[model samples]
Target: MALVAQFLVADRVAVAFAKREMASQIRSGALADLPCDTPPPTVSDVSIGGFPFLTQVLTGSFSDVGMTMTGLPTTGPRIERISAHVRGVHVPIFRLATGGDGTIRIDDMRAAVHMTYADLNAFLRTQPGRVHITPVDGGRRLEITATANLPLLGDQQVGGVTTFAVHDNKVTLVPSEISLSGLFNLTLPLGNLGSYVPQIPIPVGDLPFKLTVTNASTDATGLSLAATATNIEVSTADQKPCRPTGS
Candidate 1:
């Protein structure tokens, strides 16, 4: 039972280390000011992939490090859940545990981010007032309700189903079911409104340390982001003091 207790404690400490590193990097990254005056992001949860944390420490390498983050924001949507799977973590855990400094390196990592629909709507609201999105088709499809005034058809409310796809590290939405429902009996000047494709460029492409988004998907909760990075290195050597030399 003592061995098991040690393992649990070590797991918690290791997770805390990863969370600190992530917070440091994000605060120094590009989107640090995204949500002004908000609390800093913290580790929501973490799981060390290999069994027996002592074994990993002795070898000075870990197989996987899974992390979930909260309070991290993007320009368009608020990051709901962030799951990162890091493989081949090389860090001097013993030295760090003893108040020493070292570099933490990862050979590869895969991360997924979830954003809620309400956040996406904030971004979409920037479009023309005629376009509004509502959940539909069991939340699998977005019902785009549009209201516009036409010359002969008068004021009309139209709806369409939009298909979403991930491309070039961004979410691309294509209108699928577009038609003048109630105004079919009258002529309208709503020309090619359905042909509009709203491409939301995710800021993830500019992630720190050269992280690249591989794919994306939409779910009942929101958009899911999958990204990868190679040869990531975070070093204590690059640490900056709380105040500069001249300050």
Candidate 2:
């Protein structure tokens, strides 16, 4: 009788331990399913008071050559607010322009806009909208589609549509192409715009962007950027780890 009682107690303890282990595994899976949330950065709300400028420059040679073009307005669509639904995060938008005179010119076109992670977190905290993330096969994805009424060339009003997709910490802007002729003319013999006085759209498709989040609970570390098609690659020197504190 004493032996049987001891055996029974051991069996019950083993069963309870197994049940607890299983429960822990289930909880971990649930947390992994949670979506990643991040807010889009805010942009400037400026107006171009004059004609948009355009220019192009060629560097290197047949063996090693590079060409650069610039001239785009950084005004308008100042990100008023951004909301990331998955984590209930909000962030403010920041704007940078490559060209002077408020117009992006081809000659000196460089990244003039940048948003730090700290600013992003603040915007996320204050944004009124929400971002929703869904789990997909390989990883998670975020989709944003919205429209707004904005002023064009200062006084003229126009409707603008914005769409984006975030996957594996990479963000892709998917917007319809816009005509560049109205703003500026390209001097180069680039394909479609040569005969028609060359116009360039926002080139959202050509821009590659990515975001990295670490310790999201505390907004500890992060890095993100909107880069040009030519410079979108993984390299040791280019890797930037942005922290949530805007550092």
Highest lDDT, which number? 1
lDDT of 1 at 179: 52
- Give the top-scoring candidate (TM-score): 1
Clashes of each: 0, 23
**Cα deviation of 122 in candidate 2 (Å)?**
15
Q: Give the Å error, residue 44, model 2.
A: 44
Candidate 2 local lDDT, 1-247, one digit each (tens): 9987876676555434433332222122112212222221222221111111010011100111122112211222122121211111011101111211111111111122232334433433333222112222222232222221223433211122223444443443332222222234222232342222211121122221221321111112222232321211222112222356645
- TM per model? 0.69, 0.17
